[model samples]
Target: MTQTSNRIFDEMARLMNDAAGVAQGVRREFDTLFRAQAEKMLRELEVVSREEFEAVKEMARLAREENEALKARIEALEGKTVAKASKKTKDSEPPTSAPEA
Candidate 1:
């Protein structure tokens, strides 16, 4: 009985070692394949990284802000011109004479 038990223990240990080795090999192969694929994709597509994207987004925001400011300034100038034109029309009109008593 003791001899049988020892044999079983030895078999279990060997199986466990085999499983561990296989797992390690699979992990290494997956790592290598994934890195190669990632490199290939990066070379094929001209994709911006997160940091570069953020910087360009910030620049766009600033440009939008400047555009809005310029639009507001143009609107203000237009308003002033309209007001001046109306004032000139009013000033040019002759006053009516009052009725004599």
Candidate 2:
């Protein structure tokens, strides 16, 4: 009787172990399927990856900085031009003396 009970318990333990293994395998398969589906959806959405987004963002920043620098240079050149024109006009004008004795 004791031998029969020991055999039954061993069989039950073996079945339990097999069920746990199957459960793990199913979980792994489900994860793979989920990941694939998610990737497909994202691709269809045409979303940009983080790396590509960062690259474009950096490019935009550089363009903005260049634009600002160019604006500053234009302003400086215009100031210099105005200064030169004023100086030239002053030099060309004749000095007038009022009632020279």
Candidate 3:
């Protein structure tokens, strides 16, 4: 090949390599922008993160368990109160007298 044609080919190859590099850089920048925008949108929507949801779920579970325990404790106290009232009533009542002929 002539020297001029070889030079032209080398110039074209260099241009193509530079264009490819620029395209790659643009793609990376676009990906970064898209991810940032997506995260911002999610935040605006008030979306809960997985960690926050899990923590709230666990707290609710614990609260439900505590409520059940309190209910049981109240029932036990009610039973004791009723028993004491029954004993008091029995002790206060007088004995019945026999009937006349």
In each prediction, how many residue pairs overlap at the backbone (N, C-alpha, C within less than 3 A)?
0, 0, 0
lDDT of 1 by residue, 17-43 (tens): 999999999999999999999988986
Every model's TM-score:
0.70, 0.80, 0.66
lDDT of 2 by residue, 69-99 (tens): 9999999999999999999999999997798
What range of 10 consecutive residues in model 2 has the weakest lDDT sum? 92-101
Which has the higher lDDT value, candidate number 1 or candidate number 3?
Answer: 3
TM-score winner: 2
Q: lDDT of all the models against the reference?
A: 0.97, 0.98, 0.99
lDDT of 3 by residue, 1-101 (tens): 69999999999999999999999999999999999999999999999999999999999999999999999999999999999999999999997889998
Distance from true position, residue 101, model 2, in Å?
Answer: 13
Best-to-worst ranking by TM-score? 2, 1, 3
Q: Which consecutive 10 residues in model 1 have the weakest lDDT in total?
A: 39-48
* Residue pairs clashing, model 3: none
- Tell how far residue 28 is off in model 3, in angstroms: 3.5
Q: After TM-score superposition, what is the CA distance of residue 98 in candidate 2 from its true location, in Å? A: 5.6
lDDT of 3 at 59: 100
Model 3 gets an lDDT of 0.99
